[model samples]
Structure formats: structure tokens, C-alpha cells
Target: MTRNSLAARALPPAVLVQIPATSKANAHIDPGSGSFFVQMSLVGLLYAGVAIKPYWRRTKAFLTGRRSTPEADDESSDS
Candidate 1:
């Protein structure tokens, strides 16, 4: 008769109904496995690009004589 007991009695059923498998479905295309590989490759490429971006920028700046820091080589004639 308590609120807690009434709440406990309002629980839904736990049995889950599943759809039966079909025989005519294509067995060659495993979408889950393909999607997993694709996701992993994309994540790897994303991390690689992120890891190399700073190095690429620094190399580019150094090669082009573009000082990246405040105490870097002075290019102006303000002696």
C-alpha cells in the first residue's frame, strides 16, 4: 500500500520479442564488419592528420623563414 511498493509494482515486462531470421537475405554483405573497418581507418587517418599538422606547419614556417616565436630572428632593420 506504500508509494515505494506501488512504484515497484508498475515495472514493465522484461521479455523481449525478437524478429525471426530470413533465408533469402544476402549473406555476403556484412555491414557491421565493413562499417567497423571503415570507422577504424577513418579514426586512424584523423589522428595521423592531427599529429602531423603541427610538424608540417613548423617545417613550413622554418623553411619559408617565417619566425614563429617572439625571440626568433629579427627581419626588420630596427636596430
Candidate 2:
């Protein structure tokens, strides 16, 4: 095709449209959750203590020259 024919088929100029403003009823601002976050952190610390309790017991036993007895050792199970 010729340049003249290509120029004739070019796209039209873009038209600008006005945007509508948002209404107050559609907008909502949330109050942040502070207590829930504190509770979560406390729960995390509790979980960590629970998870480390066995290792702490083993370390204490080793330091005190006492054997972590099978009866007291919850980390292992033997038949």
C-alpha cells in the first residue's frame, strides 16, 4: 500500500472524558487493630517458650551433671 493510503487509515484523535468524584458513603477508614497485634506477639512468645522448654531442660541437666532420664526425657520414645 502507498503512504497516502496508510495515512488515510490512521487512528482518530483521542477524546478526553471527565472522571466522577467518589461519594462519602463509598469511602471507609478502618481503625487499626492494636490489641490483636499485642495478643499475637504474646502468643508467639508463649509458643517459643513451649518449643524451647525441652532443650532448656536438657541443657540444665547436662550442666548439673544429671542424666536426662528416659522417664523425664519427653524428646525420645523407646519401647
Candidate 3:
């Protein structure tokens, strides 16, 4: 017999398995999870922007060789 025929004969038939309805794992995220992810992403982005604003201003000042406005400086002085 040829190698191709021998290889085909060695493999068993494939069967499909069905899962029960009581499974915990989901194939797709529900709307609740989707909305939670969107809200978390927006909150994270807002905090990141707030956290990076100073660094962004400092980098801008360094590259331009000019100080930023006194509003940012005033905030630092209050601390």
C-alpha cells in the first residue's frame, strides 16, 4: 500500500462534541462585559492624560527652549 493510503487508514474518524447549557465559559462577551470594558478604557485614558500632562508640557518646553504658561507653574507652587 502507498504511504498516503496507510496514513489515511491510521487516523480515526472525527466526532463533534456538544457542550451542556450549564457551562460557565462563554464563547462571546455579553453586553455587560462590553460596556464595562469601554467604561474602564475611558477612565484609564482620562487618568493617563491627567498623569502625563505635566511631562508633556515639560517635554514641549525643553524642545522649544521656552517655559510653559504660569497656570501649570501655579499648580505646582500650591503643592
Where does candidate 2 stray beyond 4 Å?
1-32, 69-79
State in Å the error of residue 11, model 1: 43
Error of 2 at 67 (Å): 2.7
Give per-residue CA lDDT, model 1, range 1-79, as digits (tens).
2343233234322211123546766668766978866765654444444444445656868899985653231222112
Cα-based lDDT at residue 10, candidate 2: 39
* lDDT by residue for model 3 (1-79), tens: 2343233234422211122347566548565878856765654444444445566777888899998774662232111
Superposition TM-score, candidate 2 onto the true structure: 0.42
Residue 36 of candidate 1: its Cα lDDT? 62
Please give me the total number of clashing residue pairs in predicted model 1.
Answer: 0
Model 2: per-residue Cα lDDT over 1-79, one tens digit each: 2342223223221111123437644437653478646655654444444445556778989999988764463442111
Error of 1 at 44 (Å): 1.0
Q: By lDDT, who's the top model here?
A: 3
lDDT of each: 0.45, 0.47, 0.49
Root-mean-square deviation (CA) per prediction: 22.2, 27.0, 22.8
The TM-score values for the models, in the order shown, are 0.42, 0.42, 0.44
